[model samples]
Target: MNLGLKTAVAAFALTTMALTAASAETRVTYKSAKTGSSYYQMGVELAEAMKAGTDGDISVTVEESQGSVQNVMEVRARGGDYVFTTPPALVGLAQGGKAMFEGKGDPAFDEIRALFPIPSLTMHFVMSADSGVTDISGLAGKTILLGKGSFGATEGEKYLDLFGLTDQVEIADAELSNAVAALKNGQIDGFVTAGSYPAPNVIEAAASTPVTVLSMSDAQVAETKRTKLTIPAGTYAGQDSDIATTSLPVVAFTTTKMDDDTAYALTKTFWDNKAKLGDTSPWWNGVDPAMLSNIEGKIHPGAVRYYEEAGIALSDAQK
Candidate 1:
């Protein structure tokens, strides 16, 4: 071959190899919560963790989600390398076509499989005004923003009716991202958000304006039948006492469309780098192998491989 021709051919070969390597890189779509929420923040952190953990071999694209219901519903359309976070109870509902998913059942819902637990979805009823009532009843007569189509919104509605505040409190319908600003501007009295404790949006609102995290009493906790959680005093700005609340177990899951190798890598990287992630974000510290029992349906085969090798026990249902 002539010199120029040989050089051109070599360059073409290198370009082809580069494209091939790029194509081999696995790209994932991670759906969690809307922007400004702590769950969304965790999705961002998980994306970063995946990039670092897999040495750039596996990349995650974090997408803004309205709520866990949206995340679960998207499983119908999402196929390859798709992952999302939702409470286990929602997974069961989706499979059974119950609650918000009533009559919306699709065979795709059956493909959803559990990956790993990220953090519990702790309920937060944040208020900037002093309603004089210590528990959630104080929310009565206050305008509270419960963003649409999220676990928080659904739970908030139920809590209002359950605690007898439905008509008493004004509902400010808005996007969750605007909540902190709304509270600070006196546009809304408070908002309900569900994410890990020490939620970023709550902290932001409290720091900007004195805020109260409404607590629930023991009987009220029993009435809700959700897991009880206590945010210790000093957990939030200007909050002098501990706040009692309920939390829903949230787990990351993917469909059968994902390859086992990618699932295994993601799960392994999560537990391996969890401590480092927690150092930067307190929410990650809430995750541990013990929470694996919370996963509903069958655990992903790839995640099962990691848990087995790590000697972590899995509930019979999870196995």
Candidate 2:
């Protein structure tokens, strides 16, 4: 072969390599909640934060998820670049192979890792009428629909057990999607739901008919080992006073399949840019570094690296 021809072939190979390297971009799929929900909004914000934080080096694709259960279920079919959010307790149930995960356990759940807490899943025990029942105990002797297989359902039932209302309250087996209509029609006395406050369904229920947002006492909140939050009066139509409640902390999670570098970048971007996100969203304001204590599973190594560099204390689970 002529020397000139060999030099030309080498140049072509070098150019091809340069192009491949330049086009290399890390892509991640962030699945959280259904479209039009606050969680979905967070996903979008976080995606933007990731891109901006990395100067467009990393790209995130936000995908709508049905719910946490559906999000966790997809981990079995997802690859390393997949990330999702859920209440930390749900991850515990998944690991233990309990609740909806019963008889459906797989090695995939074991690979689940925590990223960071977004916000607490505040429980809203919305009643159809202003029954003057002040706290969770009011469920006694009332027919309540707690839904099924959701973080809300399990956590709500736990509250019922804690408050000793299990035997006293009649639990309906109806679908939660129709809970608002049922409440308006007087089909059930009330229902228990856990989500960010001012939940859309709760608002719709309050607007459609007379409603009450019951409050839990401080003692009840302490007993639940969850966070205390108050839904201030006027948050809903005709609501007259603040309602106390407990909330289950929620966290973003990923599988161990994600590489440490990508995990670190995602976590770092969130912490560095969260203040900017908070400027436009009230939910981001609720998150803090201390909430790391609430994450139940192993923290992703990449996120761990960021926390360590930032001098954030690691939770016992993470350490």
Best candidate, TM-score: 1
In candidate 1 the C-alpha lDDT for residue 190 amounts to 87
Question: What's the lDDT for all of these models?
Answer: 0.87, 0.85
Best by lDDT: 1
Error of 1 at 176 (Å): 7.0
On the 0 to 100 scale, the lDDT of residue 280 in model 2 is 65
Q: Give the TM-score of candidate 2.
A: 0.73
Residue pairs clashing in model 1 are none
Per-residue lDDT of 152 in model 2: 83
* CA lDDT, candidate 1, residue 276: 87
lDDT, candidate 2, 103-145, per-residue tens: 9898999999988889677888888764556567677888899
